[model samples]
Target: MAGAALAGLRIVVSAGPTYEDIDPVRFIGNRSSGKMGFAIAAAAARRGADVVLVAGPVALPTPDGVHRVDVRSAAQMHDAVFAQLPADIYIAAAAVADFTPRQVAPGKIKKRDGEDGLTLELVRTRDILAEVAVDPRRPRLLVGFAAETGDVETYARGKLAKKKLDLIAANRVGVEGSGFESDDNALAVYWNGGERALGPAPKTELAERLLDLVAERLRA
Candidate 1:
């Protein structure tokens, strides 16, 4: 990999899982550990890019020389990302919540004495990747992630077109030690003319390889 592959470029990354509030103390969230996105941010910084990392609730520390914006929900993440604006590259690595509670109860929901169960309403959250792709001043390079269980390539290709992404990294979820909150990952990266399978290595190594591909695409 070229040490200065992305020198002087600006990159924006979205990471982690958005939490939708059910009540003041309760929420619905995913199992994203933010490892991949954080690693990507670090790798990009290492490549000499000015990086802005819009992240959800995660316990990781900020990478050196990278700007970090902490957010809680999908809406907040969207607002933060767009507020930065006019980035050279955009990587939507976040496993954003597809839906959020229709309304958050002002107070904690208590079980009724006679009620057997309670129903919570949910509404679709904005597609962050699609939003960025459709922007009039969208980034020169846009990437998205598809965490799928079966037919990973097919589903990733569909999403690539649907979101108008330059590339999509597809991976299987729910496999033992493979996805969501896992520290180690493997990816099937798909682009316009070809695809590549990255290792089941440490997240940091995979991140560097992925950034190398992005830099190559930018050059091409």
Candidate 2:
């Protein structure tokens, strides 16, 4: 039912890590490889949805049949995601930076002989998922991803309720050989009172299973 159930739906997916520039040569970013999000985009496209993938700074090739939009900073990613509006589904899978430098140094800051340490004033970036949840052009099905190091379910459920998301996939990062930069992942997917666990398997396989659930919810 991959091609049948989701045919003609417009799906927008955000992927990779948003780089918060500290200087010309340095940035604050997570360990996301964009594999999970890219896999979801490809799976959605294969299921007959018109997919638009808004990706951050990743070296992966664009998936076939997906309209790829490349962006660097969290601000640019925010703008790009909003521009692809009025879609049927929005999957916020990107590892977006929660905070950014208050100001980017025009040039690289050099170490002084007597300086022991340096500090940066950080500011909160716009919460893309929260914004989309309240947008007038919000998709029918809005999904969010949580990469947590502790109490994954607690945090994921809190985010689900706070952001008013339809579904959230929580994964444990910092575990060797899975999540983040890994090609495989295990997701604890939660939606309201319902939840399901999907795979300690390949991202591609997990993606297809996730979309199947999405399609099921869309129909109900």
Candidate 3:
């Protein structure tokens, strides 16, 4: 670790799927397993960075030499990340709920007998990645993640610029054997005027390669 590329740096990573509660027991969430982000945190820690991982609800064990903060909702994740403030890099990898029920039921929403259907009104959650950009103490390298089914590069690049991100890792979800919950993954990482492909391997390996790129860019 003494000779590692990320030595002496501070990196923050967000992971998992945030649960938006519709009731005490029911919540809206995604299928994110947090493998990619957790892998990145572990890799960065191995490379000697002081890593702070703001993780949502996932069953994974905490990686060695990393500080972990657990959270359950998008709003909670948002608070945790910002409270940590001023990292050398920020990896926004959580698959946070885009929207949540407009108002949570005070109790369990009981099914009406013979009712054909039920309706749920939802409202957009705050864009956590975008919110980080306006911080006066924003990280030096702000990276975002894009999971799309089509036009991967186009959408990723758009978000990279739109969110004022320094880099973004994009992948297509709903494909067999990868994305979301899979341990195996790949990424097309885009930064200003450049890009790189990392895997089709274990999420851990991809994270190392991605961070290698990050180290290179940091040096540049």
Worst 10 residues of 2 by lDDT: 1-10
The top-ranked prediction according to lDDT is 2
Predictions in order: lDDT: 0.91, 0.95, 0.90
Query: Using TM-score as the measure, which candidate wins?
Result: 2
lDDT of 3 by residue, 1-220 (tens): 2228688888999999999999987998889999999999999998889999999999999999999999999889989998888888899989988898899999998889899888899999888889888778888889899999999999999999999998899998999888988889879999999998877889988888888888887777
Worst-scoring 10-residue span by lDDT in model 3? 1-10
The deviation in Å at residue 76 for candidate 1 is 0.3
Q: Is candidate 1 or candidate 3 better by TM-score?
A: 1
Flag clash pairs in model 2: none
RMSD of each: 1.0, 0.8, 1.5
lDDT of 1 by residue, 1-220 (tens): 5658688889999999899899999999989999999999998998899999999999999999899999999999989999978999999999899999999999999988989999988999988889989998799999999999899999999999888899898889999878888888999999988899998988899999899888888888
What TM-score should be assigned to candidate 3? 0.96
TM-score of 2: 0.98
The reply for model 3, stretches above 4 Å from the true place, is 1-3
The residue-level lDDT of candidate 3 at 220 comes to 75
Rate residue 35 of model 1 by lDDT.
94
